[model samples]
Target: MVKEIVLSPDEIIEYIRTEVKVNDVLEIAYNRVFAPGIVLGITPEDEETGEGLRVGLALTGEILSDYVEVDFHRLKDDILEIRHNPTGDKDDEEHLIIIEAEMFDNMDQK
Candidate 1:
C-alpha cells in the first residue's frame, strides 16, 4: 500500500493543480476534508483553525449529481471524517471534491 502523507491546506491545493491523483478527495485539512480545485479559498471565519471534519465525501451515487461545493471555512481540529456525494452536471460523471463542515474547538478556548 502507498503511504499517505499529510499536507498543509496550501500545499494540498497546489498539489491538486500539479500532482493530484484523486480528484474526489484532495487532502485532509486541519480536520475537515478538502476538494482542492473545488473551493475558491478558506472562509474568513475559519481564521482560528480549530474545527472537526468527520467527512467530505464525493458523491458517486446516481441520485446526487449536480452537487458541487467545497467549503474550507470549517477546518479546525486535526481529525476530519469526510463524506460527500457525487459531482457532475448531468453530463459529466466525474466526481470531484465537495465542501464539508464539522466541529470546531474555538468555543472550548480559555
Candidate 2:
C-alpha cells in the first residue's frame, strides 16, 4: 500500500546530529569506549513480564539497512511498513515489521 512520509530529512538529520554529539561528549567525559557507547536504548518489559530486556544493540544495527528492494518501507500517518528480506546468513528469518512511529525513523541518520 502507498504511504505518506511523516518526517522530513532535515528533522531526522538534526535529531541524529544532536544525539550523536551528546552521546559522544558523554562517552568521552565518562571515559566509556565500549561499543553501543550511546545508541543503547532499553526496551520496556512485555505486558506479561514487568522486567526490562537485557539485550544491548547499537542504534545503527537496529535502524540501518544495507539491503533494499526486498526490504520495502512505506510510511503512512503514524505507521511504518517495513518488509525485510531474510539472508542466507543467521538461519534466514523473513519478517515484515510494522512500526508505529510519529515520523519516518527507519533510515539510519548517522
Candidate 3:
C-alpha cells in the first residue's frame, strides 16, 4: 500500500521542485477535460487544513499570471499529468479555467 502523508504548501513546492524543473510541460485537468500549461511558480495559501498551494502556469514566457489554489485534500488521488513541451503549431493550444461563484455557495451540500 502507498503511504499517505499530508504536506504543507511549502513542502509541496519542494516536492514538485525535486521532480519537475521550471518550464516543464504539464496538463491540468478538471471534470474530465485537460488543458496544456507550463509551470511558472508555486506559492502558499491559507486553508483550514493549512496545506493549500497556489500553482502558477502560462502558455508562454510573455504571460504568466494564470493561477490556481487547490486544497491539499483534493490531491489525494493524483498530483499532475506531465507531458513534453509542444512544438510547431501544436504549441498554440491554451485553456483558461474559471470557477463559478455558485460552486462555493453549495459546498455544504456535498
Candidate 4:
C-alpha cells in the first residue's frame, strides 16, 4: 500500500532527513510536468534564507541535462501531496512529490 501525507515545510524537511537518503530516486511533479531524478544530496536549513531543506537533483532529459537544486521552502505552499513507497514494497521504495501547477507559473516572481 502507498502512504500519502500532507506536511508543512518544516515537517517535510524532518521527514526527508530521517527517511530519504542519497541516490534514492524521486519523482517531482510541478507545472503539469514530472521530473524524475536521482537524489544528489540534501542541504540543511540556511539561516540567511530561512529555508529548510534544499535538495540537489541531477535531471536528464532529451534536450536538457543539468543539475538543479530545489528549495523546499520556496515551494512550501505549492506542495500538494507526498507519496511514500508508491511501489508497495516493504523495502527499497521510491518517493513521489506532487506540487501545485502554479508553482512554476510564478517562478519568475520569486
Candidate 5:
C-alpha cells in the first residue's frame, strides 16, 4: 500500500494550482487559524469541474476533543463550494489561505 502524505498549509495552496495525485489518506498540517490538528482527506483539484482544493477536518485527535468532524465524501464533492468565514457572503476570498468557519462548524456537527 502507498504511504499516506502529510502536507503543510502552503503545499495545500500549491495543490490548488498544480494537480497532485492525492493518496488514499492525506493529512494537512495545523494552521493557526484552524487550530492545531491534522486535517485529513484533502480533495484534489477536479480538472473537469475546475474546482479548487477542499480538505476534511479529521474526527480523530485534538479535533475530536473539540467536537469537530468532517464528512470526507461530501467535502470532496465540490471544492469551490468551500468558503471563508461563517457567512457565505464574505469577500475574504482574496486571502491566500482561507477556510470557512461556518463550514467547519456545520460539517463538524454530529
Candidate 6:
C-alpha cells in the first residue's frame, strides 16, 4: 500500500531540515509551473539571514533553465501544496517532495 502525506508549510520546513538529503527529488511549484529537480545540497538555516533552509536544486526541465536556491522562508509564504514520498517506494521513502500547483491563489495575499 502507498501512503500520501500532505504537509503544511511549517512541517515542510522541518521535514527538509531533518529528513531531506542530497540527490533527493523535489518538484517545486513556481508561477503555476511545477519544476522537477534533484537536490544538489542543503544549507542550514542562518540566524542572521533568517532564510530558514536554503535548498540548492538542479532543475531537470527547460522551465527553470539552471540551478536555483530555494529559500524555505519564501516557500513558507508561497507554497501551494506539498506531498512527501509521492512515489511510495519503500526503499526511497521520504525522498520525494512534490510541490503541486495553485492550492492557494497567493498565500501572501491572504
Q: For every model shown, what is its TM-score relative to the native structure?
A: 0.30, 0.19, 0.38, 0.59, 0.28, 0.66
- lDDT value, candidate 2, whole model: 0.26
Give stretches of model 6 more than 4 Å off: 48-50, 62-65, 83-110
The TM-score, computed over Cα atoms with residue i paired to residue i, of candidate 2 is 0.19
lDDT of 6 by residue, 25-81 (tens): 676664565656678899998888666588887877765558888887776756665
Among residues 3 or more apart in sequence or in different chains, the pairs in candidate 6 whose N, CA or C atoms overlap within 3 Å are none
Better of 2 and 4 by lDDT: 4
lDDT of 1 by residue, 37-103 (tens): 2222222223366332122335444454333334332333343533221341322324434323234
Which wins on lDDT, candidate 4 or candidate 5?
Answer: 4
Better of 2 and 5 by lDDT: 5
Better of 3 and 6 by TM-score: 6
Could you say which candidate leads in TM-score?
6
TM-score of 5: 0.28
Better by TM-score, candidate 5 or 3:
3
Q: Which should have the higher TM-score, number 1 or number 3?
A: 3
lDDT of 2 at 51: 33
Greater-TM-score candidate between 1 and 6: 6
Judge candidate 5 against the unseen true structure and give its global Cα lDDT, from 0 to 1.
0.35
Please tell me which predicted candidate would have the highest lDDT against the true structure: 6
Q: At residue 105, give the lDDT of candidate 1.
A: 70
lDDT of 1 at 12: 38
lDDT of 4 by residue, 1-110 (tens): 23456565557656766776677666665445555566788887877866668778776556767788877667655555443333322254344443222323465565
